[model samples]
Target: MLIETLKNRLVLACLILIGLYAVVSIGGTLFFQYEPNSQDLLQANTGPGAVHWLGTDYLGRDLLARIVYGIRISLTIAFFATLINITVGFLVGSVSGLLGGLADRLLIGMVDIFWCIPPFLIVVMLTVVLEPGIKNIFIALGLVLWIPTARMIRGEVRVIRNSPFIKFARLNGAGSFQIMARHILPNCIPVLLTTAAFSIPDAIMAEAFLSIVGLGVQAPNASLGVLISDGLQSFRVYPWQWFFPVLTLTMLVLCFNILGDALHEAYSSKAKGLLEHD
Candidate 1:
């Protein structure tokens, strides 16, 4: 029965894709001897061959090596930044939803300030004022991305904050923290997981966007965005440079999206079944 479901198929495919990416990101660094940055002018602009699975760039570096490193960087940023986003969003949303009234309005107003501000302007300012690096990119993205997350969680929590489960917890002498952490937060897990899964792709793309603009991972480092930017310069002569990185990035986003959808569907189905049984 599970195998026949579309959601199950998506979940299976998503897991396989995520597992393959995880191996490449982790194992590639230790096992792959190819130096992403060491360039040989003589071997520059070579097409994909037995020696180089992808090809050589204009600077004669291995495309496969660069891609491996790039994937690691994107995945790393996405993972950590999403963690930060979810953590902050969960706390803020929980408080706002559980404690209604003026406090909720004030917190929501603060979130609005963050949401209202222009993210691109902030990125540009950060890049110019400070040095362009991976850490800075992570910080910038984390700051901006959490706004939407907080709002989403706030909305979700509001819907269930007044439910019988919450009332029972409160009536049982549970303190505010106990009620929120034990009852409310646990109930919000499915929404949180789905939101987090979908946010991964956005975080990765944000890092890539910053890298493209010279504000993310420096020149010597290879990120998917950096590779794509480098490839654009020599696009007329070498198309492989752009194609491989873009393809990898696209697949990553697609897989995460699929996983998010699959998770949401599965959770919804399970919840429905439980309710029906009750």
Candidate 2:
């Protein structure tokens, strides 16, 4: 019955989107063959044709191949970066909420400082100092993006910490680590999933924006943002170059957002039901 509620249209759609992304990122990158960086001057700026399913870009590289590679690259970076960001957030937020003292104040103050400043400005400065590269961009993005996740975890932890089950565990002589690992952490799972899932789209969007402005992945690497930027130059002549990449980015972002939203809603409903039962 509970599972049925979660298997609604939105959840199914989310699954489809995730499956598509996985297929494109894994299968396309591994099985599908074509060098995204290899250029052919003779084939440059050509419209879609039999040979090039999507078309050839300004450098005469295969647009389809670049798009596939771009999908893989963007998704790969976003996934890992989000993981890093979430780990940072989880540690800081959990410690703050669980300990709750001078430490909490200090950690929350740090979060405030980062939250007050525009993350994009920080990212831009980091790129200037760090230079445009895959790993650096990953660090820059993951650094600036953790504040929100921290806040979410802190809020959820504080609420879950006060639950009677937590008190019972404390009464049962469970250590702080045991209580957190078994009691608080399990209860906070929904918030963690929702927060982390939502962060994926934001990370992807930031990477795209930075790449478009030339502060992202450098040349010879295929990024959706870079491809979109390149296509903008010749869009009037060859629209497919720009159109396909933009379409892909939009759909990817939309799917991530919807998936996160659906997860959030489902979890909220389940939590409410449990509370009512209690």
Candidate 3:
């Protein structure tokens, strides 16, 4: 299954791009000459050059370094938020599907209530209520963005729970926990992966939006959104400040989007093949 998915050219390309971003973000300091926050007023607003690979921002901070560091911060926040989303969504969905009737209805109702509110709005409100910082943003995003994942997981769990194999397991005196842990959860891996792939870009974009509006990562700390916001101030004179970050963000999001689509297609085709064989 993994081999088949990797055979896709689009998926391979996306993976490579994402890998490059991760590597650069992780080891950027080794290659870059300047720290993200280190300022040199003499070099401020300069275009791309040998000294500043992607040029310097209004404060003369290295654009390339800031971008790489910003990518690290953005990816970090998105990764953690997605982690929380998966954990909470999986637990709620598994319990809801495994124990039906009142529990199912109540859980579904709660999900629906959250679903009705725009996720970004909920995140914004949460951020406002909490103090503005990276940790708060992570908490805000995680709390609000799990609705879609939970819904998808719930539906998948319900279907798996109704399968003949699950019924047979039950008849064999398997406990609910055993059925869920040993049987149902394994079958839901594809769904979880697909949902998680999609959820990452959403989390990245959400962090960016919050930073742009001044409700996210504060000054001196760079995020893609923070970079873009900073660039906007000097856009007319020095476009590199705005352009590089925007381009980076676009590529980052595009990579995730394509990867998610590819995973969805790969998983769907696999499932279809299995059904036809059966």
Q: Which candidate wins on lDDT?
A: 3
Model 3 scores worst on lDDT over the 10 consecutive residues at 1-10
lDDT of 3 at 70: 96
Q: Give the distance in Å from residue 94's predicted Cα in candidate 2 to where it truly belongs.
A: 1.0
Which residue pairs clash in candidate 1?
none
- Candidate 2 Cα deviation (angstroms), residue 188: 1.8
How much does candidate 2 score in TM-score? 0.92
Ranking by TM-score: 3, 2, 1
lDDT value for candidate 1? 0.82
lDDT of 2 by residue, 104-205 (tens): 999999999999999999989987899888888888888888888888888888877877888898899987778778876777777777877788888889
Which TM-score value belongs to model 1?
Answer: 0.89
Write candidate 1's Cα lDDT for 1-278 as tens digits. 23333447667777788889889877884767787787988889889999888999998998998998899888888887788788888888888888979989999999998787787776667666767777767766666667887887788789888889888878888887788788878877887788788888988887788888777888787889999989988888899999999999999999889878777777778778978997
The collision pairs in model 2 are none
Top-TM-score structure, candidate number: 3
Poorest stretch of ten by lDDT in candidate 2: 1-10
**Tens digit per residue, CA lDDT, model 3, 167-276:** 99999999988988899779888887887788889988999899889999998788999999899888988888899999999999999988888889888899899889
lDDT of 1 at 249: 93
State the C-alpha lDDT per candidate: 0.82, 0.84, 0.88
